[model samples]
Target chain A: MIVSNMSKDELMKDIMAHDFKLYDLQLYLNTHPSDENALCMYQNLVNDTDELKDEYEEKYGPLTACSAAGDCEWKWIKNPWPWDKGGN
Target chain B: MWEYEKKLQYPINIKKPDPQMAKFIISQYGGPDGELAASLRYLSQKFSMPTEITKATLNDIGTEELAHLEMVGTLVSQLTKGVSPEEIKAAGLGDYYTDHGISVYPQSAAGNPFTAAYIQVKGDPRTDLYEDMAAEQKARSTYEYLIDLADDPDVIDVLKYLRQREVVHFQRFGEALRTVEEKLADKKFYMNNMINQPNKDCGCNKPKTKDCGCNKQ
Candidate 1:
């Protein structure tokens, strides 16, 4: 679980780092499909990314359209964009 | 079929506006061998790819090109953000300014607007992969030229990063081409239209055969 007091920028940086790792791994796995070690590492990253995304959405609102939920009003449009200071 | 990520793949924090630099950088945004062409080429080519690995490789790399396109756009925007009208005209951006008024438009350094004619979506996987490999090198060269023209460390750093990506993409495309060649029939190695030929019944595998597959109608 992420620290509750982390700034939006800090949290987003962490999430983006994880997402980059996932994308890199995905490209590698596409070529080396039979590599068992890479497959296991890929699985672990997937699980970690899911957790990070969930934590991010809970604190900073949904990163994607599908993740928007809960009793709060529509939050997808509420947050600042990634280029904006708070959004990053 | 694709989702947008709001942030740049790499950060761009240019502190000064230099319209001259923006002019050269715009080439990568919409030039003949630019990121937009790269993305469209791979994405359009993936549909007819013969193997699953090649198809997925094209898709992944194509998607990354889209992100790169955004990065280049951001660089252009930042570099031209606060230039005065006189500065813009002095920088030889007067023609671009007259059209778009400091907005980022997909055009080469020479002011040619991006066109689909710049890319090919050949159904032949090997041919298309070879084209992709060449496109990466072209882009890398363009980046090198831009880096040479740019004095700003911030801009140079990003340009170097992008150039390195082109090298990596070229390597991957080369691997994909090899993968494709390994899958082709031994005798049909250099035959044109190997993937699209309807009747592959020619017994070219037998060295003593008088009528090779090539002689067939």
Candidate 2:
């Protein structure tokens, strides 16, 4: 996870924040499909979230099973599982 | 159809292990109003939903409930991790340890096994949405009760997060319900909506009103 100047915890905080924002916006859009500003924000946030995930995967390995390249090692089967201490 | 994201929706790094607290916390994993029930309830109810909004809301919220389930499972696992048998007996988990050991089995804090009968899957759209809303509120209340019993700041913090999500989900379900009701009253339900479709061909789940001659067709 040492792909950038930010520590793993700090980077994870950013990623979680982004994911939460996207999820909240998605719920809002479900009820208010015609909202103009929310629509625009949703599109931009999707791209931003994707970029963050790519950065995370590149550094710490894949964030998902689909993203696993397995070039060197099987990253999907790696440690933490998002539950253990220091997990994600 | 869902992908496993290798990180939590929110981070949980509980340092202290409290088996006594874990015993009660397991309720959220398998109790009547547990995350497992909530996820299965919403996901099952989405299929017969009349509107796109309700379906998406149910589907997404159900998926989020799965994350909550994982969080609760983690809480239970970490809280009981490496505890001695003597500690388990003292914490009143002796029966559970004898049955399931350290594994995160889906059972109530009271030791009742998880059952599908805990949730309802009425195909009626409005009925299903209302059930989803009630489920969220009940989950929120359960979290509050857990908070009252928990002294660990680490455990309380994660419980607070889960409780807050329940409140948010209730609001969303309410909104979705309002949208669906408005559409139903407007008499412009989805063309794909099974009940009283535009062509009057699909009439499943329709009430026996004069307007709904589903049986006549």
Candidate 3:
């Protein structure tokens, strides 16, 4: 669950933490596909991360190029690129 | 087949602008054992992989390496931001600055431009997997060296995270290599290779099934 008061950096850290866990588990499951415990954790992270990503994109601007930009203009391009200082 | 993510996989906020450090770290961006080579090596190898598991593993790892490449680029970009020409000269990045003034370019610290010759993509799965394993080790060592040279605590933290990732990737790649070996030894998998058109599915693994997964596609 995301705290409404959290800063963009904090929310991003939360998302990155979830994604790192998910990515590691994905790599593990690539070889150990039958591991039920890992699979369960992976599924849980998938749901959590998706929710987190939606929240992030909704508030902080589009993470992906095709993400929603309220209104007719292009905000994705306006959002700070990753290389911008503290942009992430 | 690829979608662009505007944000970094990991956040990097390097407070200090150290052109010297940027020069050294740019090596990982485009050097011989850099992330670019790592991503290209595995992605290029995916089509030739012998099994589904091997193919997926390579593809995922390759994609992740692209993220790592972004991290390296960010590190370099952040480090070089606002650096003065005098500082650049002092950092021995003079030659680099002459060509690409404050922009991140894919070249080594010693001035060698990135080349495809940096990576190997043998058609043989075992041979290519071995090369991947070695590549991971080389990358891990490069991170270690970079960490050792880094004075900024912020920079070191990111480097450490990236280093640990290299370790995890090494473990995963090693596991993938074993998975490929086991599949190669399985009679069912061996038989599936004689497939009909890929679209035919052929149900090639059944005991009653034979001569499937061929070049008819």
Q: What's each prediction's TM-score? A: 0.83, 0.87, 0.88
Put down candidate 2 lDDT per residue, B1-217, tens digits, no spaces: 8988888888787788889899999999999999999999998888888888889999999999999999999999889888999999999999999998887989888999999999999999888888888888999999999999999888899899999999999999999989878877785544645544555755555456876555585
Of candidates 2 and 1, the better by lDDT: 2
The digit string of per-residue lDDT tens for model 2 on A1-88 reads 2245767788888999999999989888988899999999999988888887877887777888877856866778888778877885
Give residue B3's error in model 2 in angstroms. 0.6
How would you order the candidates by TM-score, starting with the best? 3, 2, 1
Q: What is each candidate's DockQ, to 2 decimals?
A: 0.43, 0.80, 0.73
**Span of ten consecutive residues with least summed lDDT in model 1 chain B:** B189-198
Give the poorly placed runs of model 1, Cα more than 4 Å off.
Answer: A4-6, A68-71, A78-80, A83-88, B185-217
Better of 1 and 2 by DockQ: 2
The RMSD of every model to the true structure, in order and in angstroms, is 7.5, 8.0, 7.5
Q: Rank the candidates by DockQ, best first.
A: 2, 3, 1
Count of backbone collisions within predicted model 1? 0
Query: Each prediction's Cα lDDT score?
Result: 0.84, 0.88, 0.88
Model 2 CA lDDT for position B127:
88
* Best DockQ among the predictions, by candidate number: 2
